[model samples]
Target: MIAVPRAQLRRPLLSSVLHILSVLFVFDLVFAVTSRSLFSACASLALVGLVAAVSNAKYESLREPFVFTDLSLFSQLFSHPRLYLPFLSVGKVVAIGAGIVLVIAGFIVERPVLPGSRALVWLAAVLPFALAFPVAARLPLTLDPYVDQCRNGFFAVFVAYLLNGLRPATFRRFREVVAAGPFATGKPIRCPDVILIQSESFFDARRLGDEVAPELFRRFDDARREAVWHGEITVPAWGANTMRTEFAVLTGTESFSLGYARFYPYAFVRNKIASLASWFGRCGYDTVAIHPYYADFFGRDRVFPLLGFARFLDIRHFASASRAGPYVADASVAEAIVAELEAADDDRPRFVFAMTMENHGPLHLEQVLPGESSSRHTLGEHASWRDLTAYLRHIENADAMIGRLLDHLRTSDRETVVCFYGDHVPALPHVFEKLGVNPQHSDYFIWRNYGADAPERRNLAAEELGAALLRVVQDHGNRAEQPHASEKAT
Candidate 1:
């Protein structure tokens, strides 16, 4: 093989350096108006840009040569292509004009056109690229070169606004893209009496041995007598967005149906759902929803009604009753359920979907029960271990609450079926680190909770859980009919 020339090697390196410098300059000009210091702005851009470039380059190298034609991204984009028209109109015209001006200005401002003289020109180009890099990187690599170029065009316009230190109108457009979707709509199916309890951070911490709360394990054992107990449920988020899981269980659709790669119940789902409430409502049942948190906390005010609830009892309704940190206790929510059962005017059966909030997050043993040494006794000094213990204690509190509800249901004369599951796992980053648990494992607990007498539990998506629940209800209905038929034949 012929030896490579030094000039060729220098050419690519020089070009890359110039490209980087150009990106930096544009970034500086844009940031400087607000930052008030050119040097500081340029320095910040240089640092951030370099990191981003290296990351992008590494990511690009690992992938199969960035094929630019894949229907999936295009399909997603076109599914709500109307959302992008406004951005396209403004961005295309403004970005092209600004880019041309910056290129021309660079040639005029820098004298001699040599390495030193062209410094300002390089800065102008680099700064714009630095500012727009994130947007560019997020674009699918499988798009056509022209599509990538168009994305750059939008970035340029966005940068012009950034330089002027003005927020872009594109923010609203993004919200519209996320918001586009039909609300869940389907003919409802009549079902048996339904009770759904979303247990707070209910995962199996027994693997951590004595580090778990004693009351929690005791309550878990107690719950098994009357209800099916799934050992560990893998949840998506540790301490937040529990409603997303609830939404999935209520609606028989996955995150993909709402055009999200991840679970985001509040953002994607907007329509009335064929939930247990809706189904029971069609079946001549009185429907109500209970949550100890704010009525509006996950847009539940709008969503619960769509899910077929006739009424929702939230924190405002329970203002005088009981208190847990930042929310009404689970016990209070249980009372609300009992109250709804008693108050139903319709002769139809009642279906109540109650969410417990007493065991809400920052699940460190200390944050949950302050100044209480009994809560602290089970957990140890190790930060990694203590979190698991705290999570168990939280679960135990939820378990005890469930046990109380179950006991009440048992004593009551009305026939009721209570289905309880953890929404997601506790938000313990350290526990995840120790257990090597994948976030994807969040929906896996359905398998553990399925009893031997119960139907097989397959791995399911969050959105699919509602469908599974429907099937369970259907099975219960079928079994109920079988006995009735046998008695008639005898």
Candidate 2:
């Protein structure tokens, strides 16, 4: 028998306690940033760890369900830090670093983070799941509606649910979901090239006639006249949450069906379901997703493929000289899309989904003094509306981008269809209060170089826009049996 000193045994125990406290302290502080209460954050500690692990992998800023759904996205972000490192906040970088330090300290320091012996780090890691049992689910009372007195014990319940999903009885339902049908069902039309512009905060402020000068929206007004389908769209999110609109348009999934996933659809769901891209892929169109930002933003880099995009053109794909203000200018994006269309001039149909980022939030800009408002533009006194003025300037630039894109498509010999819409309203809290603008509704216009007249302006949901766009595409000779060189692999 081996004898151990009391001092050594006591020291290790104290170290273990301190270590656990430190781990809790770090996560509680980190999770507190977004969680409503510290208790809720602590209760979801394991969930926090799971989110943090994925966030660290993807160079992402936050750890909502959207960022945690895919580990592969993290690996993609890790492989190309250059694309996203600059986008992360200083606080996020520090917190992530601190978490790593604590994790390493657990293995070597005074005590392990796990409950058992300090030397058994791996066993400690598995202890929580190993200890969770079915009997705990039968507890008499519960604090949270979903779980019993145990919080991390929720993991055991989750495991049970997962196993239940994999049971023989549920196999038929799983197969049914996987074997879904097509989107564009009409006579397999040889579709014309499709271009969808998810413009950043590009709405016509002219609607607020009293608040703005008519001259300010001249370019916006000019672009609207060319639309085949013009109207306002009620998006899922109010001021922000771009993914909600993106998901709705890509999959044409109704807002009510999204539930909690509405906030970040890119993260929560991992099914190989049919979408616009999948439908386009089936028809042999070259599907491409273009966005002037980090490839991993919202895990788009990984999700695009699942959505059936054959290629993705991100910020790295754009030249540095193309930048205007906070991001690659809309004009540059317009040029890039045209260039791709021209490059694939071999007559193969193309479907390009381009997301613009020139007008992102934090609209703090130089204040125009009381009387110094530019006489050239008619936005009341500009100094007080510095942010609004800045936004309008970006919108002006976006209008130019729209004109360029439409002009290119019009001049091209191959028939084309384009849908231009804003993802959501700008999160200008002050502006929203001052102007009484309904940020819930955004503007959208579908334009084709050559097509029949569209219905008068009408209101529609974001999810309903794709089906409408497809109906228009079918009319304009969609699905041109020609194969795009870029998508030869498919």
Candidate 3:
């Protein structure tokens, strides 16, 4: 069977021609170098199948098709197979492995097509690249990745998007959007140490069914009750791409405004714009970012400083922290936050933003705790019970971390604030599929240690979260300056 399915082939004649030519170009390039027509054909077909397989998997798990933005992660995908490979089935994994082996064998065993003619082989390889230039220059391009992929073939669409991304106009628009002023302005009467925890895969599990005990989110519940603001925030991403939501909240810029940069803002946007951290920095606060994972995963090590963070505490800082499962425990991250706050010798207010990793997905890989699959965690022995159970186990720790941070903030003599929010929903397609839950929203809350402001419940977009938190902080500052009833009477 042809790797390019008929469904994907339903396109205009122009698109079909472009797609065919693209495939032939790849085949020709390989055939010229390897001198094996059969292997070149197989390699081209394998490339087509791989793109389709990845696009389908992403759409299945992330509700979005593969776009050029995904190509940026191609290198990391190999380095971090555990994070992605689980989403692909065993059959698909084996097929991919076999395709790779076939290509390697072909390279070794097949005789060169143009043996003893190095110049001719080089010329043949260069011919395809030369031909692709004019063919690519006049091709129709669309920014809508999903529509483009469906209307045109995967190979053509990928090339189109790649070419579009390289255009100077794309960068100009991104810079225009980023040039806007900082997220928040005006210094507070007294700066309070602010701690924002972007928790991993945190959502109310009780939504799954009656079996998920309400107590699972008890600490979270308590925090909400006493919060200055709490609600469901619509995040940019669904199962993965935590940075999309992270960028929105930190920068107060909607993902939609980012164009192609929305998919991976950290890597795409070269210049730093106004972010919550940067705003706080100007307000005399010491800004720091903490993530208990590889700092370079999303280029955070390079981007964080640009975002106005004075210091970054990545996996290196948590080397001594205990692991709850595959990653560092959220509890240890909580401890690190507190330590960072208290370790300061001076009186400068600190703004510490942390991203938790304990609950990062591929939960099925880990066995559910002995009793995790019990009625308390799952309604019954359903197919997705194990994944749900493992999720709840980590969620329990995340809740504990919430409780710990709240406790620390509530007792601090200095005025303090804590913002807790989920980066995105967990990767639990099977669990959601079984329960008929359309996982879209993630929960968020901004709480203050000492304030008379009544608890306000309001739903907001991820981009608006930082501004909302800033409003609460500024309100607290304004109220602190007002004369008390007793002072006024005196």
| Clashes by residue pair, model 3 | 35-113
TM-scores across all candidates?
0.58, 0.64, 0.89
- The list of candidate 3 runs beyond 4 A from truth reads 1-9, 115-147, 181-186, 481-490
- RMSD of candidate 3 to the truth, in angstroms, is 3.8
What's the lDDT for residue 221 in model 1? 60
lDDT of 2: 0.60
Each model's lDDT comes to 0.49, 0.60, 0.79
For model 2, how does the per-residue alpha-carbon lDDT over 1-490 read when each residue is reduced to its tens digit? 0111011222223233333433444444433332323333343554445443433423222212122123334565577554345445566667667765654454344331222333343343344333332222332322221232023222232233333333454444433433343364443454678888898866666665455656655655655775667889888755455887888887787655543233356764455667788888788788898998888777887788888899999988886637656678999999988987887756578889999988875555323445433532355664547777777767778888887887666667766788888987765656666677655678888766654453457677888888878877876343244333223323
* TM-score of model number 3: 0.89
Model 2 misplaced regions, further than 4 Å = 1-188, 269-271, 365-384, 476-490
Candidate 3: clashing residue pairs, number: 1
Candidate 1 has a TM-score of 0.58
Candidate 3 local lDDT, 244-348, one digit each (tens): 999989988878787667778787767667789989999888999999999888889888988899999999998889999899999999999989888864678
Which rank order by lDDT, best down to worst? 3, 2, 1
By the lDDT metric, which is better: model 2 or model 3?
3
